[model samples]
Target: MSENIIDTGKLVEEQSDYLLSFAMSKLQDLELAKDLVQDTFVSAITKLDSFENRSNIRTWLTSILNRKIIDHWRKAETRYTDPVSSFFDQEGKARHWLVEKKNSTSVETVVDQITREEATMELYNCIEKLPPKWRGVIASKYLEEKVSDDICKEMEITPSNLWVIIHRAKLLLRDCLGKAEFQ
Candidate 1:
């Protein structure tokens, strides 16, 4: 039993980066992603007896991380917005404002002007400015690559609710990033 435990522990350590990256992709916050990864390992270790060899260890651990991400989102969404206030009421949805549509910009120009490290840092800074709720979903879904069903399950949200949150978050992120231009 002890030997089996050690093997599981080793496996977890070996796959920590993959798991962490997966969670970070979904959750976006490095600290929170790290916490979720650690928690997943702990949960897996405690439930080691359930390992029936039906699935790879990484898959099982990722499933756990997906759940954790959803839980994080649910808590964040509930905490940030009041149910009664209706700040994001469907009726009040913003109209599409493309007052001045422009052609696609060239990324090559920007890429050539900045070092990779600098560009990465700038993007990181922009991401850091995102609201917690928005950040969590982007991190988990985009960064972590967890499925929508898993995300919804973790956050205890309906698909519609998830869509609304994601939509609003993107708008906010766009506005926030726009502000960076002046600074």
Candidate 2:
């Protein structure tokens, strides 16, 4: 048991950086990648007794890391998009009018009314109001700047699903922004 613990500790220490780098490549955020890697190791360590020896230890650890990365994506993706309230609302037409109205507002009035901090907080609150699925896709693709392929892989979605999610998310965001501006 002592030897097993030592081996596991040594393995984690040796592989943590590589695991973290891999996760970072997938996640594009240093802090979240680090957390995912750390969580992976912790989970692996806790489940060490279940090691069935059917596969290489490194493979087992990597599988755990992959799952961690996916979970992180799932959680992070939900923050950037909103749920589709009405799919047939003709977002493009509505958006053009909204932009016109917003732009017609005096620049000084806009600036005076919303400080940077307030704008950011309001934006965050709007994001929080989005439906869980739309939020995830938007967060992963737009906010995190992840490629579609990467986002799809992380979210286990197809290209069609990705496009649909993005379209709905954009509509939701536009609605949210419109509400914020009017408020």
Candidate 3:
């Protein structure tokens, strides 16, 4: 029994680098990625008895880490400040200050040629303004080029749920782009 435990421990240890890499790729924050990987290991150890052998250990650990990432994003979304109140006056009327001031003397030149990099950057900025879960769905569907079924599997959501998420994400992205003048 002790040997079996040691073997399992060794297997988990061997997977640490892969797990860290995966976390870092998804999170883009080094410290958060490290913390998430550590959390995954702790959760795996505590819940070892519950882990069925239907999937490999690496797959199970990755699933746990994915949940942690989603939880982190959900918390971030909750922390986001809504800009609606800022755009309205105390009387519930649209504030005049919300309108952009037009410059009459100097005409701004419209750039006919926008670099691909510039457009991509603008798209990313608009995507970032969306709620975190929406950003994840957009990234998985468009950036990662994953099929709907694959995205549904990865998100652990039903097909209908995946469609709903995609629909909501698209609406949010469109609103964000319009607000940011990136449309």
Candidate 4:
């Protein structure tokens, strides 16, 4: 029984970097990754007795960290919800805060502004579902607005490969967004 027990301090020392890197890959936020790792340790230690020792300590810790990450994303999806009233007037006209006073802006522009925040959030959530390499590729191409040549050089992929990756990522995002709309 004693031999089966994990040494908390030693496990932390051995696995901290690996866990942190794993969290960083999934979350892309340094501070949040650190917080999740700490939370993982706390939860694991608190429930140490329940650990069956069937798997190694690192795998156990990783499972706990993954759960924490899922919970964080779930909470974030509902956080900072925009009030529908804020976008509409009492007469039911859409608010024009996002547009300039110039009349040249079209109705599509206003509608886009109204739905932009929600769509952006949904797109980000979909991006999170992508594989780590694809996530980085999508971020560089779209979010960072990197040129194709530069992205190819940076990611060490050919131009054709870059387009293929982008196509796949976009397809995944479209599927995710479609499903999110129903939910």
Best candidate according to lDDT: 4
- Candidate 1 segments exceeding 4 Å error: 1-4, 87-183
TM-score (all chains, Cα) for each model:
0.45, 0.43, 0.43, 0.43
Q: Which ranges of candidate 2 are over 4 A from the true structure?
A: 1-6, 83-183
Q: What overall lDDT, based on C-alpha atoms, would model 3 receive against the true structure?
A: 0.71
Cα lDDT computed for each candidate against the true fold: 0.70, 0.70, 0.71, 0.79
Select the stronger candidate by TM-score from 2 and 3. 3
Worst 10 residues of 2 by lDDT: 85-94
Candidate 4 Cα deviation (angstroms), residue 143: 25
Task: Itemize residue pairs with steric clashes in candidate 4.
Answer: none
Query: Candidate 3 — worst ten consecutive residues by lDDT sum?
Result: 104-113
Model 2 lDDT per residue over 62-88, tens place: 678878877766776677644443222
Error of 3 at 133 (Å): 40
Residue 99, candidate 3: Cα error in Å is 13
74-169: candidate 4 lDDT, tens digit per residue? 788678655676678889899795774555778998777647745665576568779988898998988899998988999999989998998998
Winner on lDDT (1 vs 4):
4
TM-score rank order: 1, 3, 4, 2
